[model samples]
Target: MRQWTTGRERAWRLLLIAALAAPAVCFADGDAVTAKAKTSLNIVVGSREARPGKEVSVPVTLQTNGLKPAVLKMTIRFNPAYVSYVEEEDGAAAVGADKVVTAFELPSGSLNVVVAGFNDNAMNDGLLFNVVFYVSNAAPQGTIVPLTCPSGDGVLSAADPLAARLDVTATAGSIEIICKGPPAPNPVAGWFDAQEGAGLTWGESAGAEAYQIYRSEMNDPATAEAVTDWLPSTARQYVDASILANLQDYCRLYYWVRARNAEECASDPGGPVDFVINEIPDAPSGLTATRGHSDGVLLMWNGVPNGAEYRVYRSNNNDPATRQPVSEWMPATFSFMDTTTPAAQYGIAAGCSGRLLLDFFQYTYWVAARHTNGCESDLSEPAQGFRGLPESEAAGVLPERGDLTAWASICVLLMLAHRAWKTRKA
Candidate 1:
């Protein structure tokens, strides 16, 4: 009976130990109670820097590590006092193990989304997921972004706080100028020319104190050579005629203008204006020519200053009396290829004979320059070239005899014959 009782007690104690050990084993294998599940939640705002009138979008992502899925109830709360909140989509209640996304906008208020939540089993955890929204007429100029997530749980769970500072900035405004010029040919005058001055205009701006005008002759607008004193009020139009000049004949001239406030603060340089200067007319010079290949002759001359056009004349002979001008004057060019002035037609050389060729042939040509203003220069030096047979034409026409002996014998016979005839006659 003692052994039986001892055995029974040992069995009972073993059962108690087994019960305690089983729970420990189950816990160690992670099958006892719901394993401490870990989940990661994140929040993102589209643009931390938003304009006062512009809208902003915010997104939230939740992730978890566990077999059973978690019911992630994400609620974005904003500081109603500062900003307005508009829920773009309903809350994501049961967020799977995978990532889930939710977006919202700040309709009105300064502070945006403030809290987030996750429900798993019967346990609930609140996540601090908040974003602040702000608006301003001007850009927020700074490096750091100010964002905070204020979180709290209904179950009194410790609030997990999160924050992200936004990098907000403002956009700059631009100033430009449009220019108008005078009619062609007449060209704008100096300061007196109304069309010569640059036209100034401003695009968009809240309000400027006093507008200032700046000018620079060099291409660089930053290094302005001159600046106008601060005006009493902002002006849309300002003329800078100081740099205008009639003597400026270059193809292109550069100009730019900018505005400033009463405090002497200046905006960016205005758009650039390019002006074209009209050229003045001048006369031609140095006209001359020489015989070229073929029956043609080549005429050349130096370009005339301020000369807009040229006229060329051809004469049949060097003597003005024998010289009749060609039918019409040819338009002046740097060089004239006189192919039509044939050697025969112009009585240029002795070989030429077609139309009552002259015995003594000497031809001449002349050139004159005309300006755009109808100004003409004196005729160029007459270019004279001669073409005629030499004084001893007989020498060139006779043929030469190779043997004088034969010619001598022939001459003696002719003399003897002449003597015989004379004797007979006697």
Candidate 2:
């Protein structure tokens, strides 16, 4: 009996050892699968400056150096009087997860967040969740709304239920409630997306730390809070490149410039400047196409300042209306090489081959400058080039199809045959 008991004990010990040697499971893919680095759960409370009765939505973000958690639970604590809890939004961490279960009691000042996923699919690092709170109208100016994450209430675990995580931490941030009304308004002077550059020049504001540039589609209002990060006061001009790609070719864009003080107070949006984004850039200068090489045409032009690129158009006719772009868009370079070989076309019934029957083809070329804001400049002066049969063989080639070399050859053959027959009859 004693020997049998010893064997059972050894088998149990071996099973335990094998279990401990197994690799831990992960719930997220990519290089950040292993939880080898530290993980921090931070409360990102925004909108420090707010008017009374305004709603503030503070986000809870999960910041991790290298760790990826499959399940996370955090509890937030805040005062109920100054800022009452409105509701919870799980839309943040619910992404990529099977489901996110969140439970919180309003007016109690404490909320809990729980996010979990199955298998190797879990929410990556970013905003874990959002908690919204309302500032009381009666709340006096300079009121303080404190937010905190209590100790031991935060839990982050790996996919394996049995796995333990000991390197996780939590941080808390707060929002200061203020009722400072909108600052005085300062109007924007002028703005343009032209040869000089794409930006706006505005009047300076006294006691301003920085200026804010705001934009909206045509006929829409630009709000002060909608302005992007503050620009240094000295940066009186703001060059916006995104407008070039987003706005339509001829659409009107509205802009407003405001000043932000050191206290984060935003002045009223100033200009309803109807800055047009679709204006064409200045026409390209010195447009010329040369037959320098045997196989290609060389096109060169002078560069346009603040120009996004150049468009090259080609047509058999000299009329600008008939010309079509060689390519959709090209870089802001001053040169392009066209290697398209001219081919011959044949129509037996027509006598003259319809295809550029002339030994040499004349092509008209035009160049245009394109600005960043979807605007295009007018066509440059018309320039002509001869392609195909080398210049040596293209002495009297006309632009019309019937007078081409193909028709001339046929006419000469017929006349010679008649002359020969007449001579034999004589």
Candidate 3:
């Protein structure tokens, strides 16, 4: 709040003493004159609320002893930060005041007013003059704008000889500056993709108790129908899985957020942000496998358009449910070499069946294209191929491979060696 003061406290007191020193009426020669009637003057101002950038009036009223007064004067001191003086006018034109002087000075925030009557009889009790003020837009909310008599002096006085001593009481007037309402929240726009869904996030508002998300398709302005239900203040983001799912790839979505305070006052919608749904690339096609001989199987596929990378999965059989990723993440290549060597990066399991058949291998392979935004397509058609020697010609030491070939190979090799040993023994 701006600090303001009227620096006339001492001077105001001295002036008030001088103005009230004389009895109500004095002779032309300055002889002491006693008033016939006792009278009082009151400065009345109503208390009210005022908005910034508006004009407000405070009336200074004079209540006489039912007798007319020949002279009157009023002075008002105020806080300049809250308001500025515009003008002042007589309380009633019918009374026909003789002469009136009004002066308003800044920095001191003071208004001095004086009026006199030209008629022979004393004037009736009524308004002295109204002081008009303009409430400043920068006025701090809840700050009071006061119009008061300085040092309780010069509030009201009369020169009517018929009136005796006058008793004056002054009441100060005040207008409180009330803020319009909740101010608009500053919103920062961004997108969020989480396990729950994809969405947009906005910055929080200082006075907001809740928020509403509004979305527009094709960059159009948002409508009420597109607005979400009021969300708790804690929710700074809104996710609608269906919106992204339903929209065409690369299409735009415009969105904004409105903040609401506890009083149900909602701020205007914030600026809009753009959100584009990205399309997932198609799965790689034309996948083919070749023999890697003793190493492993070699797999290749045609690159999918718009594919940022490719994911490879291998399975012992054609079933995808049995498939597991060959590596932790997708490789940025269309060709992958599945190897059986201990140092092979793909880490293909050497023993699929219980029997350890080192020579021959058959594997199923497929590929899926992945987008930069993490969107992935379905796996391509499975391809079956072989490497090394076929199962029928296999004649080597075999462990318990899951398939029966491992056991059959081990038994057949042992049988052939045993037959040769028997012939030699005979």
Candidate 4:
């Protein structure tokens, strides 16, 4: 299961506030769905602390467990008296939404924060998004503003949002009105980079001296280790260039960062965002190369399930690099007819000076498949083709018409002279 977390990073909050505060996210009013949902998701909201009149960003994280939902809408309830829903981003887009696609504040002090995205099969890794709140200045200290992720429909205490039809278990979160905390770096957003591996980017933390990155095979921080030395406070991103060394197709990678002071570290760490690499096509199978009519060679190979194209390679004299592809990147073909086999180079080297040479020539060949992603499969087993011997010589690639004519003419003159000599002797 992959879990994404959120936090109160000043950089994201400032940008988010600026984007939505000027013009609050607005969407057409719609009815809320309280339908019992069935999904494989577990949503968790982490707790945060802020002083009265201060703002806080609570991470809204979830475990996908590899189930990419077609759509998700999470409706939340918050206390307006204790804290106000600050600038919200409309999330018709998906997780990582700064503002929801639509927002509804009920007269009963409940808020419907609907966040939704469509992904029927594919999935990416990272924190879903964060919920921001502005604590009322008049609110008393030590008050906890609950950001409750309540269940909708049925006796099911919690379920996926209406129409989502996914089984969802949500754990609610809150913010305590207190003034004791160190400024920490914001949660990171990560994505896969084909060239360099997983890429991580975070916002500048408040009063941070420097930053350091950590990585782990699992999502747990306890299993993580710092992969980089202290980076300058101005550094906001890092790329896991070493990931390709251990990466497998479609494998997942995890990373996170933390803020530091001159003599201390933040009380808490930022998020451990994850990313999934892409998958390459499998190697082709069941390759066969046999002698075609005369000296031509026929090649056949089984198609790969994900293969987009196939390549052919031939070698004479057993050198793998000798033969170039008679045809390259052939699409939708399982076989090729190599009429130019007994390559001219090999033929010439095998004493092909006479019109009909009883020379022996051998050719070896291999085949491979290519994926749409430009990844090539391993070459198939070598198949050999022969150009000499009794069977192959008769059908051997013919030489020029004039190659043996001069020799034939000389033979006729010698025969005439021998006959005349015999007559004279008689």
Report the number of clashing residue pairs per model.
15, 2, 13, 15
Q: State each model's CA lDDT, in order.
A: 0.39, 0.58, 0.58, 0.58
Clashing pairs in 2: 244-372, 280-376
TM-score of each: 0.24, 0.32, 0.35, 0.29
Task: Name the top TM-score candidate.
Answer: 3
lDDT of 2 by residue, 1-426 (tens): 011225665455334323432211111111222344233222233334455678877655543333355666656667777787777676554565664757575456876656665645455555565677788877777776666655563234543532223322333346678744344345565656544334666777777777777777544563323445778868777676665554564445667877777655556666766666565577889987763234456688998876788888999997988988886678888888666736333223333322334245568889888888766776889887644444444334433323455565775576678789999999
Instruction: Give the candidates in order of lDDT, highest first.
Output: 2, 3, 4, 1
**In candidate 2, how many clashes are counted?**
2
Give candidate 4's error at residue 288 in angstroms.
Answer: 99
Which numbered prediction scores highest in lDDT against the true structure? 2
Model 4: per-residue lDDT, tens digit, 206-308?
7788888888866788788988898898899888787777565434456778887654434256887976464445667777765323446667888987788
Candidate 4: minimum summed lDDT over ten consecutive residues — where?
23-32
| Runs of candidate 4 exceeding 4 Å displacement | 1-39, 89-100, 118-125, 154-163, 166-172, 181-426
Question: Which should have the higher TM-score, number 1 or number 3?
Answer: 3
Instruction: Put down candidate 3 lDDT per residue, 1-426, tens digits, no spaces.
Output: 211223574345334433432111111101112343233333344454666777776555554323455555545667887888899766662145464545566468877655565665644545556667888878866788765654433323334553332222343356676654455556546674533444667777878898887766544443534557889989877676755455444334567777877755567777577654666677788998764343456778888777888877888788997987774445577787776422111111232322333444567888888877666777899986555433343324332123434454665577678789999999
Candidate 2 TM-score, C-alpha based: 0.32
- Alpha-carbon deviation at 286 in model 2, angstroms: 88
